[model samples]
Target chain A: MPDLLSPALIMIVAAMAIGPAKGHLRTAVLLLAPLITLWAIWQVPDGVQGTVKFLSYNVEPVEGSALRRLFATVFALMVFVGGLYAFRLARWYELAAAYAYAAGAIGVCFAGDLIVLFLYWELMALFSTVVVWCGGTPAARAAGIRYAIMHLLGGVVLKVGIEGVLISTGSIEIRPLLATDFSTWMILCGILINAAAPPVSAWLADAYPEASPTGSVFLSAFTTKTAVLVLILLFPGEPVLIGVGLFMVVYGIVYALLENDIRRILAYSIVNQVGFMVCAVGIGTELALNGAAAHAFAHIIYKALLFMSAGVVIYRTGKTRCTELGGLYRTMPVTTICCIIGALAISSFPLTSGFTTKSLISLAAANEQMVWVYMTLTAASAGVFLHAGIKFPWFVFFQRDSGMRPKDAPWNMAAAMIIFAALCILLGVAPQWLYPFLPYPIEYEAYTAGKVVFYLQLLLFSGLAFFILLPLMKRTETISLDVDWLWRRAAPWLLQQGSRGLQPLLVFSASTWQSLEALSKRMAVNYLGQPETADSEERGLFARSWPIGATALWIAILLSAYVFIYYTD
Target chain B: MSDSDSQDFLSRPQTIRRLWWGFSIVLALTVAAQLVIYVKGYFVVDGWFGFGAVYGFLSCLLMVLAAKALGYFLKKPADFYQQDEDDA
Candidate 1:
């Protein structure tokens, strides 16, 4: 009853209804659920608290605070809308798994203990793979297999770190660690891998677009954002992440700039968006952490909004690549406008959601006098506008006007996008709506002439560069190289070569064993002559010693007699 | 356990042309609201600025289009991995 009183309970219950309930009931479950969830989440008072325990571990499954509660609230809302968008076309398993996955993400938001967080963390991993596998394409199946392996490896590393912390510190509270120890860094890496930091970045673009449209929408929301949330809670002030985050920031833009598929470009941009949050967490100031959290908050809305547009395109035309798709603004005008809103928000254009929030983190870098990090982040901001903010909407909606326009998004799909689009603008227009919920008080201003003009000029110029350099940047039918190449291409190749290299060793061992066997048999025969055995001087000098001794004695006796006679004369 | 009883609901492909049109109408309303805001003193700009901001918008737009053109060419076939890889 305590949990049921919460909106998270209602939203999840409604999501479960997507799979089975017949006809109109499913429709009701789809559309009205998110609203109800939003209402219930609104009612959860500040400082509302509850807990449940098992196995001598007290699990703070629900600690109701404005911050934790808001994240959970958004997560629930994401699920309901995602459910509405999905349940119609998505398979039962995909629908069911997505709901369970959302619950896990919301579960983590509410978890006050590391143990509970770990449990939910693994849950997110398990169900997301199911969603990816639900793509049902051959590509989906292969990508899903690889996706599962990568996440499971990440989970093992995380679990090892958790166990190490539990053994050494004798606690499992979900509090910030300075990342001083091996265990902590391992835990951070474990989480960062999910955040799609370097080296493991290939798994995301490799997997997500292969997923069914509905699944991609769900996949985009949870995993990396949860990593950001964990970083906010666990390693808030670690400076190493600044360098790491910067690398991911620009990496996403360049790779995305090179990407051809609409969803995959957005996929790379997710890492880039997460890099902002990662940097904020690295800055570790209250405002910076809030920026990270608020950015995560707005990010979920805008990122999901972009995915919805792409999903709509994929659904109508069954084409996902930017090359195959262009000039849809002619047919799908509504989708175009909504996607533009999302794009503007992600680019941090003045008066959009991204404008209000992402700057706080970047500003924090500036205030800290971290000039290199600041410049890197600023260029990355421009890069965001270049790759995702403009590129996504332009290719899918406007561009050369590909002359084939199906219908706009379905009611559920449009509704989801509209709701998110509203949030993106609402928060931007009035920062107070999202500000208080941040981990830190945001005393910063989002709308200054200097700042706005600077961002615009940077983004505007980048746009010019993209156009000016257009000839060099042609979309060849190729995927840009990624860190995942190590596993997907390089490791598999090395494995083949390694086996090739071992062939000689195998042959040498086989021949050597055979020769040794023959030698052992010859020795076991006792004598080479066998039954007619004769041992002779051929056995060597040790056997012939007595003949030489007898001859020497006779010679010595005669030599002594001759010597004595000579001496007497 | 049988959904055949609800066959009418289950079988129909659901023509949402009306719904789609309705949502578009709503979008028009929002765009109108923005137009209204522009009309009133609360407006940030004079209007959507059809050709007035042409260079700014076009420079941004064409830049995106060209990048997109390149992206299309750069895009590997969906089966790019398979082209280089054989399971054996």
Candidate 2:
């Protein structure tokens, strides 16, 4: 064993302790585990720290780099904050599952080989399903099953690719590879599925909102962001990601615009935000990679803050629809303010974390002179402000009053939101703190005069458009269908239709067989002997009785004829 | 929690009107700031005066309308999936 313990182990062990421990002891484990993990994360020096023999291969379970540390830092931070939010209210099992899920994500951050990465990846899939199921509703159970299926499918595809890579390249070390071969392409597809890329992206919007309020907050932080991290590590510069990323950006905006559920809106926006990172990774320059890494970091905080606020609403009012929520700003001031800050940060407004990190991606695109991608991404930026930045706060907090006044979040939840909300602004204002931790050296400024002015014009006008078209964007108690409809609705309907279509053929075949049997029986009755009685009329040839002496005489005559013919031949 | 007493100031009609006017002015100033400050842009067209405002507004308009149009096909009742679960 290496001198430095794996940070993932600490969280997993804490997760184990959480279920049986009670009161302050459980709380102590919940709060201290992540802090201890954070300390352990920093303790590991750069490069591969240790290896263990597994089967025939020496697997690297711990690697240290700026990128790895950055991701692990956020994962640990998320666990700590998420624990603080949930410890008081969340069920013991939910808290346990959430910690385990966080441990899986942290494990992936330090994984030094494909095999190690895969084990952690699956650990995440298994436990996140448990988190989703913690919602404890039939809906949650069903959604958890669907969520499990999609991620497990992704894991299988990833395993197949890793196995193929190991066979062809004779190595399992996690390194950059292009989608130029079957194995690499499979790897890219697998990662994209986890990233919630299109056609298969609906599982995220379907599942996250259905989890328990606090569970959703934990659910929101880990899975897709881990997918983004691995993409940064394994498949940077894969050109297909640009198109996939752009689609996600636009898809999120459109669907979120049409959605009525508050958390579902945020869930779609997760896809949209990850789209930015995925696109940045595709750009593949040092600046682009930094943008992707920094954006992931900033995104996790603000997105979690947003979820935390929404979770508070769901926790207080048991209502998830936009139509059922309004005028909350008066009563739940802290949550409203924190949510707005998160919204602004997501919109990449002038002095928020989103602005600082997301602009780096657009800057990367511009540096490459990819005019179309730059333009489209610039437009998508405005779209984000419309769907998430204004729409979320407006519908839930500021629109026509629902005449219900729920109290503010409980102290711990409020503290969690305030902490992340503060981080959103802090990182935005002082990106120098974040930039140094990026994988590459920094050579960019986030708040140049031109950039700030340009972004302000873009976002503010989009805000204008939002209010101007408020009627069109009204909540309608509806959900927009996505590709998951294939399994959720279309595939099942197809099976039903198929069975309906096959019914007549099956009947026809059965009738035909019955008639053939009758015909054969009639032929036997006519050609061969049968009992000539009314009771035996329906009997088939094999069922009929014949006179024994006549039958023996006929057999003997036939045998003699056969013997004569054989002798003549 | 009283409906009349707890009505938020921002929701009052007068405050709303004032907010609308204030917001409009800020929007105008962002575009007008281009006169004094030369806002460098990577793309040629993006550099044009009020381009960000115009493009941003237009893109949002297009997206909202596009979503509304898509809603006709894609939008289903809140229990869309739940209905299937019930059948099963």
- In order, the candidates keep a fraction of the true contacts of 0.11, 0.87
Stretches > 4 Å off in candidate 1:
A1-17, A31-51, A504-569, B1-78, B84-87
Question: A1-569 in candidate 2: lDDT tens per residue?
Answer: 66435789999999999989999999999999999999999987899877889998999999999999999999999999999999999999999999999999999999999998999999999999999999999899999999999999999999999999999999999999999999998899899999999889999999999999999999999999999999999988989889999989999999999999999999999999999999998889999999999999999999999999999999999999999999888899999999999999999998899999999999999999999999999999999999999999999998888888999999999999999999999999999999999999997878878777888999999999999999888789788888988998889989999989999998999999999999987788765546466575556656667799989999999999999999999
Model 1, span A184-204: residue lDDT tens: 988998999999998798888
- Give the per-residue Cα lDDT of candidate 1 at A423: 87
Note the B-chain TM-score for every model. Answer: 0.39, 0.90
User: What lDDT score goes with residue A252 in model 1?
Assistant: 80
Clashes of 2: 0
Model 2 residue A531 lDDT?
A: 48
Interface RMSD of each: 10.4, 1.1
Indicate the worst ten consecutive residues by lDDT in candidate 1 chain A.
A536-545
The DockQ assigned to candidate 2 is 0.68
C-alpha local distance difference test of each model: 0.76, 0.93
Candidate 2 Cα deviation (angstroms), residue A50: 2.8
